[model samples]
Target: MGTDDGMQLAYYIVLLVVIGGAMLFELSGRGGQAIRQMMLWVVIFAGATLAATWWTDSGARQQVLEGGRIEIPVGRDGHFHLEAELNGVPIRFMVDTGASSIALGRDDARAIGIDLADLAYVGTAMTANGEVKTAPVTIDEIAIGDIVDRNVRAWVIGGEMDGSLLGMSYLRTFARVSFEGDLLVLER
Candidate 1:
């Protein structure tokens, strides 16, 4: 075997032993109490997981709204994510009604071929982390499945944000936007 490979193997073995020793020491000091608590937590988590699975699968889910509509299911964290195409590139956006316009993070804006240095940050937006600069721009197209929009107004936010936001600007294009149970249903 190569000398470097042997050295790396030894290093990994030592690291694992150290971590295992620390865990053993901590568990031994707790006199089996820590282990019992861990087992209890595991049981509780398993029960909750099974119950949530059953609850969601129980009902006769989502009959189509008359003609047709898009239904976004709420995540376990209670947020709705819509998979969309921005300027023909696929992306995911979090549905945020509180946001006035569609706000894109730096990376996403760049991915859609926006040159950040060329844009002017003249507008400001009040966010949870305080006000931040915004550069207004028109996106050529944004599409969710068959629903497509052209020349949509959006902002490239200056500071960090969780991700792109699908705000009222886009949501308003639909005839109706409603929430039923944990689903965000959009009627076009």
Candidate 2:
């Protein structure tokens, strides 16, 4: 078989294995001895598969290399110390350039004591679930990763977002950005 054919066959095998495992687990809900043995076999197979993949493949290494922006070693604190906030509400943001403007969660806005009534309803925002109404507000300050900006423009969504997302509205102002593993490096 050709390389493409081999790849397709491998994909199908993987899919079949996944579906079979799910079906087996569902059928094993009766708590029989045979079902318990089957589950043990499945666990062994999963571990063996993971070990084989790690031993035979460099895809994970290649992906890590390609996706690197900056590499920061783990600090003593065991967590990254990044400065970030919008309108006095602390925001846990991942640097996503795909977003057009600064996005804030409704609850987060309220937490920071943002008066939603003062914001202007500009338009609708297209999200993963559906469209949501948005209001524009000028923030007094937004600090991130040790950097702080004043009078930032951000949009408040009608519903709850996963968290406040700091996107292009903030990232665009940076001169350069890089990540060293878990550390984010930003230069303005």
Candidate 3:
């Protein structure tokens, strides 16, 4: 399972432990009030975590702050995601600092108006999912709200890709890339 899955399991374990403790307390002449309070705390903690996780990926949307800054709240899977204009078409990309360059999947490349059939998949890249063939391409324009770049070099994955990766090549254009709490901030 993924990190999120592990975390969710841990959360359930904690909840069960708390409930058990509360049951013991009630049996030891405490009362239903104590059990209720304990359950309330568990509910509150879970709600907060769920609410934070639900932000953005569930439609909170990226915030284009003033002064060329963009903030993307972390997704439920604990990764940064941004919806950017790739060749003027909106495409969601997962921020991956480990990636050397922006990597696009077949469908995303196609949506960006790339003619995949003509692409030469002579290049290769080693990813977490092993090696995959790539086709070199230069995007005419990519925009994140008001921030825009032209002639950006990216790779079109000729093999299976989990999704498009917003990698370091594009992130390097930002004057600052930092994380504030659960939000990933990119400032120009």
Candidate 4:
């Protein structure tokens, strides 16, 4: 079931349990006071559940750029993932501060009209898996929200990658890059 469906089911189940307990108390001669107390508890539970759901579903944790700054929430994997337009094509990149340059996946490079076959794999990078060959390329423009950079240096990895890496090459251009709690903030 979807998240919303599961949340709704949980709400109904909690409500039923509260009503059942309240009815039992009334039947045992506890009277209206017991029912009222149980109802109050039920309302509190529902409100808490709704708040939790809203926090997760509201996109409040997603990337947002305002003025000359960009704020991105840490993903479930503990990395900041942001979407940008690479040479006018949409691409998702994982923010990697450890990387010296932007590393683009083969598929992402191809999607941006890069001639993969013509690329020279002379550069090599050491990844968690192993050392992989890379081809140097320059993107005309890379835009995230309203922030845009032109002629950004990047490399296309010879091996397959889950997603492109937005490394220090692009990030260092910003005036400031820091993490605040679970958010990564960039200022230019």
Worst 10 residues of 1 by lDDT: 59-68
**Model 4: per-residue Cα lDDT over 46-154, one tens digit each:** 7987887687656545565577788888875678887889888999789999999999999899999999999999999999989999999999998877888899889
Candidate 3: 10-residue stretch with minimal lDDT: 52-61
After superposition, the stretches of candidate 2 with alpha carbons farther than 4 Å from their true spots are 1-83, 179-184
In terms of TM-score, which candidate is stronger, 1 or 3? 3
| Model 4 lDDT at residue 139 | 95
By lDDT rank, best first, the candidates go 3, 4, 1, 2
Error of 4 at 5 (Å): 17
Best by lDDT: 3
In angstroms, the error of model 3 at 22 is: 30
Question: RMSD in Å for candidate 3, one decimal?
Answer: 6.5
Q: What is the C-alpha RMSD of each candidate to the true structure, in Å?
A: 10.2, 11.5, 6.5, 7.0
lDDT by residue (tens digit), candidate 3, 47-127: 877786676337557899889999998876778889999898998899999999999999899999999999999899998
Can you write out model 2's per-residue Cα lDDT over 63-162, one digit (the tens) per residue?
1122222222333334322336566666554445667888877766777778877777777888877898899877788755345678888889886676
Q: In candidate 4, list every pair of residues with a backbone clash.
A: none
Ranking of all candidate structures by their TM-score, best first: 3, 4, 1, 2
Better of 2 and 4 by TM-score: 4
Model 1 clashing residue pairs (backbone): none
Compared with the true structure, the alpha-carbon lDDT of candidate 1 equals 0.80
